[model samples]
Target: MRTPNASRAALTLAALFLATLSLAALPAGVQARSSDRGKPMLINADDADHALDESQPTVLSGNVVITQGTLDIRSARADVTTRNNEPTRVVLTGSPARLKQEMDDGSPFSANASRIVYDLTSDTVTLTGNVTVNQRGNTMNGPRVVYNMKTGRVQASGTGTGSGNGRVSMRIEPKNPTPADESGND
Candidate 1:
């Protein structure tokens, strides 16, 4: 059972997830509308010494790097699940797995976490263990975070294990006029 607001939120999240994959490109000052959904996915690894089972997850270890369009991900190891020759999910693990992408607003976005799980089917990204996300000058830190690329929504939780002592921290910079905007052209 779900409440009205909860159902609405869920629908929005689902839509956002889908949009993250299907969007092409949008103007600046806006959230990223373009996605790597249809782009070619390339993976590079120092060592790929394991058998790949189509029905099972494929694990890549030793400096794994994945790239598609403007999205780049790096980790010490990754487990990729594929469906019909396409990747449906990826679980990345490292001292701090890193992910970077260009937002629709022309800002750079980055994140680091010990474990990152990206689910293509649900279009959601979950980060756990010392998760940190940065967009332009803004920063967020927490023990766990779930990000919706399409809606730019982020949900974070503290590091506490029900002790209620942990806390999530965030820093958001205010938007201000640049030097050029402050001074008119002569």
Candidate 2:
């Protein structure tokens, strides 16, 4: 038996959990390059298997490299899913898969992990298993990291356990101050 207020509170909590799970926004002033979304994606690999059915995943292996505009990804193997012959998602695996891209402010963003999932529909990249992310001279290390390419929001988490390296860490560099005499009026 639950009171009406209790039920409402439960619903609100559930909604907040769902929101946090789906879209964790990063700090302001850190966004990926918007123009990269409009660019064509190009993939290169030593071997590929394309299924007859367009919905089936296409597998690429051996030194797989994928690029779109300033965004670049490198992995030993990749599984690409398509909708209407356009890639909807890509899962990359390697000893440690790598990704790099230029941010809107011209700073470089990079990540490395054992597995990486790039979801085109959501415009998000999820890195798992000993993940490391670097952006704007700051670094984050954790068991999992999710980056929203569109919003440039990043969410990182640990293993959620008390034992053995179940923690997340970050090193944030201090921002440099602008000089007052840069106007050059003198």
Candidate 3:
């Protein structure tokens, strides 16, 4: 025998899951609006490899692409490390990486960098070495960027590249600056 409240809760949960699946099937822009409910998936090419350490078993080299909601990350070489079959970390390197995600307001963001590191347990991702992110026509040029997968939080910092004078540039779309504005002419 089930109480009325308990039965109602079960039905609500079921409805939520079904709705999630339905939304995930939509295009990327649609997914952005309903991104609160979606699953992260990974795809790997034949060249990808995984190594748990030198002495342990290792998968050879290949292309690996990881997708989460509206976010997509592609890399040439990837190594997946796991303990007890639970993925602890993933490293993507060699061919560099491109990360694309749709912003909440329907704008798109793209990040290009040398390497991308993801920690499953911590839900954190770090992009290193000449990392540049372009979003909503604004560009963030930094050596590194750390983003929390679950919380949508990002921190940008230099990867030991010191000049103290970091550069940040933002550009609004449909509007183009004149030659003098670009060249800093008098």
Top lDDT hit: 2
Clash pairs, candidate 3, are 47-61, 47-62, 48-61, 48-62, 49-59
Weakest ten-residue segment in model 1 by summed lDDT = 18-27
Q: Alpha carbon lDDT of residue 55, candidate 2? A: 50
Candidate 1 scores a C-alpha RMSD against the true structure in Å of: 10.4
Better of 1 and 3 by TM-score: 1
Which has the greatest TM-score? 1
lDDT against the true structure, each candidate:
0.62, 0.65, 0.52
Candidate 3 per-residue lDDT over residues 1-186, each given as its tens digit: 323332232222222222222211232444343562365343445652334343342332555554556656566765555565444565667446766666567766566768766666787777677776665565666777677756756677754545454543334444455555666767
Which model is ahead, 2 or 3, in terms of TM-score?
A: 2
Ordered by lDDT, highest first, the candidates read 2, 1, 3
- Per residue, candidate 1 scores C-alpha lDDT tens digits across 17-55 of 333322212234455426654565566777653333455
Reference-based TM-score of each model: 0.64, 0.64, 0.53
lDDT of 1: 0.62
Pairs that collide, model 2: 26-153
Q: What TM-score does candidate 3 reach? A: 0.53
Q: Which segments of model 2 are wrong by more than 4 Å? A: 1-30, 33-41, 83-88, 119-124, 147-155, 160-165, 177-186
Overlapping backbone residue pairs in candidate 3 total: 5
The C-alpha stretches of model 1 lying farther than 4 A from their native spots are 1-42, 49-53, 68-70, 104-106, 148-153, 160-165, 177-186
Candidate 2 similarity to native, TM-score: 0.64
Error of 1 at 77 (Å): 0.9
